[model samples]
Target: MDRDSTLRVEKTTSLKAVVKKTYVLDTNVLLHDPTAVAAFKQHHVVIPMTVLEELDHIKDRRDKTVSREARIAIQMIDKVVDNASPQDIQAGVPVPGSTPEDVPRGTLAIYPDQRLIGDADVPYLDGTQDQANDNRIINVALSLQAENPAEFVCLVTKDINMRIKAKGSGLIHVEDYRRDRVLDDIDLLARGYEHVEGDFWSMISEVDTLREGNCTLHRIPRKSLPQAYPNMFVHDDQEFIAFVQRVDRDFVYLRCDSRDSLMHKRFWGLSPRNLEQAMAMSLLDNDSVDMTVMTGPAGSGKTLLALAYGLHAILEQNKYSKLIVARSTPPIAEDIGFLPGTEEEKMAPWLAAFDDNLEVLHGTDESCHGSITYVKERANIQFKSLNFMRGRSFNNAYIVIDEAQGLTQFQLKSVISRVGADSKIVVLGNLAQIDNKYISPLTSGLTYLVEKSKAYPHAGIMHVNGIVRSRLAAFAEENL
Candidate 1:
């Protein structure tokens, strides 16, 4: 933000208009927020023809969310193209009320009185059609800036590097606020808390006894605290213990109990395949622990194990009241609509992952005495989409987040805050199979949990390495 930019914003009547003042929307931006064009209102919004070309390329993806966004964009383009007239043609449409509904939506006419800009002259301006998707969007902004040298041509994108490129291209660039900006440190900290105790090593070795209640132990080494501290306690009083635990080796093992093991099998479908599962189960089984994160590869069984545990806690143990599960349906830069149904119907495809896990728990035996009905009757399970999760709190429940690799840190934080008292959250995702390019394994929500949740006794992190799904799936995960 520069002085001129600051003054310009101050002078602008509305933030939306200020944001859209001579704006060039990148294709990713459109995919990230399908309503972006609508939100910009009367301002000139440019959608490079190449962007439409790219949307056409991804219109047939197997993933529902990606395919839906691409399809919706095509429809929107058609609406604009249909409304534009040869005489008073503004790009495609004049943008609703700004011009007229009959004028079509999303048409751009830089100068109504000047010679009309032809379609053939579109691609040859600032950005070359051969450039990358992000680069081409930037080029469009630059070309627009070149045409309207007096007006500020702002390029909106979720891509950080693209914004930097726009600046280099001598065009103003900004991140799309609708989908940009992850959770802040303060907000993220609200999901869990950390406390350290006097000693580390000795206490970790006595985790089983410590979780049992009525036990007094002294801290031995600052390093052994995280392993020794019971996974249930997350408060200022536990900081000493966690800090001491951090002093030891980077990783520590958690002790698992029968309750934890049962829950793991019930929610996720399988049991402890490696040391990580043992530790995760230990933390999850403990009443004091409020949140636990499990990260691994595709066949590592993170989602299955977490779901199994959640199911066990709710059904067999009569612990939580319900099982609420969530996951991001990619591409991360896409809308939730275009699935051709309501919200629940839209999420059906993504929820299939959890449904398959539940099916595994139900077993293959058809004559198993109404096993499907038995499980449904025993446990009140609900699958929810992230879009509709806002402004809701879940109390005394088991929450599972699958495919967490696609969530931004902000989204993870939002989900965690929804956990009420006596509720536990299980976040599991395979970082290796991440489909969102804006985020990687190390920077994803799952990774953020593993890194930040370490200081909280009530929060634990586990990384699964061994593959147990199937030989083919395991081989693909390992070799591919």
Candidate 2:
């Protein structure tokens, strides 16, 4: 019954360093995320000599994005080891961020693989072999493991082959850099819609119905659909469909609609071929929504949907002054000035999909080519690269960012911020078609944006589930 008997507590005044493990980072890890050094959190991070040399070479790459990321990684390292002596750098320097207890969390070190000495007691990979830099990095991890036998040593890389090779070389701990990984399974990625079995209304035992001008609103208890977020769609097998208009702490407000209304919505003379496209078209036409992100497999008509909406908004509705279509192009391809007339002309090669869609729109005209040309001029369409999109604002424009899967969060954020006054941006990507070497569906910027913006009222997300391109194209998307 005594106060001391209920709970016993003891306090001790003791402090110990948190650097119990050493992590040798690969060049790709740094390129993937420039700020990866600080992610180790309370552990020792090592930048191998070979990795630094790789970064130095890549800093001047023709690819601006890669070069910028490499430069940022180098600058981050420099900022950490600014005034520290060579010995201190080789040993360990305290990282910038501190713990809540006002203690330095971790330390970063530069492991000079070139100065490594071979010992018969240690197992080291051949440094002069093919993949010499990779071998050197693995050797640094091996050397650390051998020298500090009591401490844990790990080789962190974004390269699957490097991980396999490191494990084959007798390194016990090797892992991928997962600081940017938002989901463990790609299946769990937000589809921007929820499918309810039977009738959606059957689950809601009680609801408050109200009217907002020309629209009908239903306020359902948050528990009925706890997973609901703004702009999400709830559909039932009985043809019931409603768009989530907004969400509050206690209830969800849904703007009721029918499948027929969404399907009948026309965009630049293009009608929805499926229910998913219908939802996407509706979202694009909503003036209240500033951004719409669409993700699905190839041949799902994401490009066509975005293009049709841009044309409708610019040419028909007079919603914006210009229609800007942009996408992330390959680095060598991005050197577009070498080949062409104007920036848009240079970009024509990469943005040919929009032209294809335009052709689809004007194919029935007497002179298809003339019709396309007239549409381009009438709509004031412009093609721009994501690289130069920085330091500029696009006002009163409808922007379409295509092939967004290959972008990182930073790249996507910069492009999204370029959307100025009265501008609406639609980001299109196929997660399965991500071609970037360092990104996967779970870490892709498209996935990042979809997950991060679900709670925002002005943002909408849609994943066109069906492949409506053609029978062969759909076959390839499903089976190949």
**Clash count per candidate:** 37, 0
lDDT (tens digit, per residue) of candidate 2 on 1-480 = 899877987778798656567889999989888888888877899999899999999999878788888999999999999999999999999888723446557889998788876678878887874756888999999998988888899999988888999999889999988878888898888888999999999999789999989889999999999999999999999999999989999999998888988999999889999999999998899999999999988888899999999988887789999999998778874487676699899898899888888888888999999999988999898999887887799999999999999999878987898889999999999888888888888888888899889898999999998877789988887787
Collision count of model 1? 37
Give per-model CA RMSD: 12.5, 2.8
lDDT per model vs. reference: 0.60, 0.89
Q: Which stretches of candidate 1 lie over 4 Å from their true place?
A: 1-213, 216-218, 223-270, 331-346, 364-369
lDDT of 1 by residue, 1-480 (tens): 678876664445654433336767777765654555655655677666666776788788655555566777677656555656654444535655443565434445322212223345333233443646666666666667667777856777767777777677566556554433334442232222234454323245433223324433333333543333334222232222121122234433333223334334423345676545555565577676678777777777677777777777887688989888777665444446666676655777878776676677766667544775566557777767765675699888888888887876656776788888878888877766777866654456666666666666667666666787889988887677
